[model samples]
Target: MHRLRCFALCATLLCPSPLLAATVFRCEDPGGHITFTLQGCSEAQDLQLHRAHNPTPGSGQPVPLAQTGKTTRTRSQAKPSAPLVVGEQGDGCGNRVTGSARRTAMIRQQVLAGMTRSDVESALGKPDKISTQNGRTRYHYRDREGSSRQISFDDAGCVKGKP
Candidate 1:
């Protein structure tokens, strides 16, 4: 279903129309999952709109998009039921993670509670902001537009607070 929606949106948006101003939305769900949609991020505080400079011929009517349901997936393509426990710096053993696409997907699914500061930084890059309270520190990272998530570390450095 998600793939279908994305494909439909891409088809419609990719269809050039002089009178149409396409609205592409980048959304970060409450759980911090990221998605691009045909409509706006309903609850996003950091929405951005991009308009095509070139115009095509159309009466401003939105293009019709195909709505094919989800396609079958192979075993290898399946996501893990539980995210792998990565190393303190990303992979379980001490190492700097690489691979932009894979790293990003992994970061999105990482379990933060046990992650060290270096692991978080290596996965998500620098935090947008940092603060401390009662001897504990928090790191805030921004996602898709305005969505933000934070990880707090207790005195011993394990993430604090419920996920």
Candidate 2:
């Protein structure tokens, strides 16, 4: 019958097929940073592609892509800026020193990035540790050191005590 044939065709078209399903991929970098993207995983090195099922609407579930493949090229991105550094300009230490003494005595030491506490102490000397309760690192130094009568390094490792 014409009606039966039409019904059979509709059912065949509505059924799900593997060829029409989407694929999902998990990407990772050399540093172990992982990310999920919708693009195919052809060029992505160390990337894992997996076939996932599509989720229902408003089900709070993740829906997988329909294709799985590797990429041959990587997209370039911009790098972040370096950390900020604090300097000492004013204060009596600069004036007290003699003529050329000012330049030689008042030397500014910019702590290198990723330097540990021991490294800083070795470069500068034993700092007078100040008590802190609010999760902050504060070091105090008097006229014993170079210029800037008082010096303080904040939690971010910036000098703010005095210059």
Candidate 3:
């Protein structure tokens, strides 16, 4: 009985506790800049609260994402659960500039969030300089006015934040 009690006490002391959980906020400003932080955002920006906890190994559950209204094509879902379409406000992806080809051509005149490298290239023409680091790609451009602009893309080749 004494050995059992000692073993139990040692196991209680040595075994790791569950990973710490945290509350994160995803905020997007009116201009379409997205930021994730522990601190909350101002009322102006759209805010989303995400409770993150590290599940034990072999839990067989996926990590939770922010509950945007739109449905995503998850591996487990046979069909999209929600009836929302792409480019909607609550979609997991950011606000994309979508419309008819002609309208999109006009929209692409100015770089915006949720654009692809090809779209940006078509809008602003080829970049003057290109660099890649940490799986992120950046394009540097010099306009006729001698001003400079830089756009960055994530590993998935989509624009990151607002330009």
In Å, residue 92's CA in model 3 sits off its true spot by 13
* TM per prediction: 0.33, 0.23, 0.38
Q: Is candidate 2 or candidate 3 better by lDDT?
A: 3
| C-alpha positional error of residue 76 in candidate 2 after TM-score superposition, expressed in Å | 34
Give the per-residue lDDT of model 2 (tens digit) for 45-116. 478877766556676765655777885654564443785558754333232324443333334443333333
lDDT of 3 by residue, 24-135 (tens): 9999999999999998999999999999886766787776567668757868867667786665343223436564542466465777666778878878889999999998
lDDT of candidate 1 at residue 151, scale 0 to 100: 83
User: For model 1, how does the per-residue alpha-carbon lDDT over 29-75 read when each residue is reduced to its tens digit?
Assistant: 66777767766777644566666333455646555558678899999
Off by over 4 Å in 2: 1-110, 145-163
Whole-model alpha-carbon lDDT for candidate 3: 0.79
TM-score of 1: 0.33
Clashing pairs in 1: 18-56, 46-146, 86-92, 87-91, 87-92
By summed lDDT, the worst window of 10 consecutive residues in model 3 runs over 88-97
Strongest candidate by TM-score: 3
Candidate with top lDDT is 3
